[model samples]
Each structure stands twice: as structure tokens, then as C-alpha cells.
Target: MNLTLAIAIIAVAAGVIAAAMRRVPIGQVHSLYRRGQPLRLLEPGTHWVVPGLDRIGHRIDLGGQVLRFEQPQADSHELRGTVYWQVLEPERAEATIDEAPQLIRCGALAALGESPLAAGDRRDLGSRMKQALNGALRERGLMITRVELEIA
Candidate 1:
């Protein structure tokens, strides 16, 4: 009975240790939470957390992302484009990482809607949209690197 109890305790300890150790991969950041509250951002490496008391809230990719959107204009035409962006600050972006794509899409549609559309102005429009998106996304720790609009 004593030997069985010892083995059981050792197995439980191993399980707890395994649960406490977290390994974050390269080019990714994890948001640590304690009892449903935000704690901190965990960078790429091995980390330890209190078993059952702490959890990984969000796993944010520190890599580039692409958002493709299509918006219809009053002229019955459509504005379609791909936006290239990435997370510059995971700490500030943790809250909006999941909504980044939707935010970019909405911002792009609004910017395009405000501009006068013309075949000769597509290039200028792309640049303007990039600027507008970056302006809105900067505070969220995201940046628009490039905006590619399809000429149609």
C-alpha cells in the first residue's frame, strides 16, 4: 500500500510539472492570464506558470498577415484588394488580434468610399488606403505594409 501511494504521488507531481511548463514557439507570443485576468505577454521560450491557476489566453502570431476585401461602391463597381500587415507590438495588440482582419476590411472600405474612384487613380488610392489603415491600426500595435488593389 505504501509503495502504491508513493507511485501515485510521483505520477501526480509529474503531471503537474508538465502542465506548468509551457513552450512558446518562435515568431509567436502568448498572452498569459491568471484566474481570468490578463497577466502578461510571454515571448518565445520555455515558461512556467502555476498549474490550474494560470492559463494561456491568446496565442498571437508575430508574423505577417494578409487581408483581402471587396467593397461595393455607389457607382455599382467593386473595390477589391489585399492588405499586407503584421503585429508590431504583441502587448498592445493582444486584445485586437482576432479582430484585426475585420478592422482592416472596414477601414479599407471606408477609405475607398470617401475617395473619388477613377481608373487612372487606382495607384494613388492604394497608397491612400495604406496610410489610412496604418493610422487606425498603429495604436493597436498593427501596421499596414502594402495595399494591392485589383484594377477592374
Candidate 2:
């Protein structure tokens, strides 16, 4: 009985170790940074990760992702916007940004930053934001599918 228990424990441990070492999947992309440089891209299929040496990062969808930015109103203006983007190069996508969401946020903000609109101009601001996002994403090898404004 004791021998059987020991064998079971060993089996479980081995399984866990194997699972840990296996590559992450391709649908999910992991950003690898080494010495503050985008080092490698992990795909969805599976990847061997150095248990301690290489840091395993969050899984970002290589496929299209949708982002919504709340329209900020300072006085009497209404603001609301959305952006849809997809990764053109999985490797570049992973390597380019520290965090996928941060990249998205930054893109949205950068797009917004380039605009000359004031706080109250929701429509103009949204249009400028879309243009800006597309321009910025082009640099990162990402494609912006669409930008839409919500009525609410």
C-alpha cells in the first residue's frame, strides 16, 4: 500500500513537471523580454519555458481584440469610443509591447493625443482617435479593423 501511494505521488509530480515545461498554446501569445528587449514570442501550440530563468508572461490573443475607451467629459461634452485590432505578426506583437492591454491602451491614447480636438468634441475626437490608432498600430505591425462609437 505504501509503495502504491509513493508511486502515485511520483506520477503526479512528473505530470506536473511535464506540464510546466510544455510550451504554451498558439492561440495565446506570450511576450518574452530579456534585458529589457523583446526577446522571443511563444505561440499557442506549446513552448518550453525555463522554470526560473525565462519569465513566463500573460497570454495575449494573437487574434483580433476589441477595446473600448470611455469618453471623458469635462464640462457638458459626451465621450465614448471603441477600437478593434488584430495582430499581423504574432512574434512582433509579443515582442513589441510589455503588456497587450497596455499596448492597446497606449495606442488608443496616442491616437487620441495626436488629435487637435478639445474636450467637448466627441465626434471629432473619435474620428481622430481612430486615425491615430491606425497610424500607431501600423508601426507595431498590427491592423485596426474598425473604430465605432457607442450611443450610450
Candidate 3:
């Protein structure tokens, strides 16, 4: 009888552990899904989730981050450096569901496509990339803070 009782208690404990548990770390946000549909955004905190019902989707960083990319050119030239960006609205980032690095790279490449790079001061031209990136990213609740590039 005692062994059976101990097994019962252990089962209950496991169930409780699986049910009442969720956490979002600082400088990040997570998207919650219920019944396989997007529910809401979970900010940094301890949260409670319904086991087997509510699920966590993407964990997006809210803090500033930089992504280093190597952009290859036709003349064997490659511009390789990092781009800085920050999430203005964590909740809105859920809609895009794309990671920060991908977003930064996409925006930077798109910007470079629009304006062809020419022979000039690379520093001056690289710093101006932020202007082009913001045009694509601002609507997605992200903004390009700065662009640091090394043109090779």
C-alpha cells in the first residue's frame, strides 16, 4: 500500500510540474500559442501555462544586437561587417517571427541593392546604411540603430 501511495504522489507531482511552468528571460520576449494559434506575447517574467494546450513559439530578443554579414560582390569584392539593430516593440516582432539577425541582414542587403556602392570613403558610405535599413524595418517594429561595415 505504501509503495502504491508513493507512486500516486510522484505522478501528481510530475503533472503539476508540467502544468504550472513558463518563463521568459530578461531582454527577450516569447510568443504564446493556444490551440495552435497565436495568442499573445510573453514578456520577461515567470508565467503559468496550461500543459498540452498553450505552447511557446518564438523567443525573440528585445535588446540591441549586431549581426555580421559578408556581402559578396561581382568583382570578388566582399563587404563584411556588422549591423546594429534593436526591437522597438517586442509584441509586434511576433508577427514577423523572424530572428533579429535575419532581419538585419535582409534590410541591409535590400538597402545595398537600391543604392549601388561606388569608390568613395567606405566609412562614410557604410554609416549611411542605417537610412536605407530603417525604411524596410521600421514598420516591422524594428529599427536599424547603426551600420558598421568593412568594405573589402
The number of the candidate with the highest TM-score is 1
For each candidate in turn, the TM-score is 0.92, 0.61, 0.81
Per residue, candidate 1 scores C-alpha lDDT tens digits across 1-152 of 99999999999999999999999999999999998999999999999999989999999988898889887766777778999999999989999988998999999988887444788788998999999999999999999999998745
**Candidate 1 residue runs with Cα over 4 Å from true position:** 114-116
**Ranking by TM-score, best first?**
1, 3, 2
Local lDDT at 88 for model 2: 81
**Residue 56 in model 3: lDDT:** 86
Is candidate 2 or 3 superior in lDDT?
Answer: 3
Q: What Cα-based lDDT does every candidate model obtain?
A: 0.90, 0.65, 0.78
Q: Alpha-carbon error at 122 in model 2, in Å? A: 8.0
Per-residue C-alpha lDDT of model 2 across residues 1-152, encoded as one tens digit per residue: 99999999999988767756746665677776555566676766666654445665546676778877764444434446677888787665655545555666776665554333454565665677667776776767677777766434
Position 68, candidate 2: lDDT: 74
Worst 10 residues of 3 by lDDT: 110-119
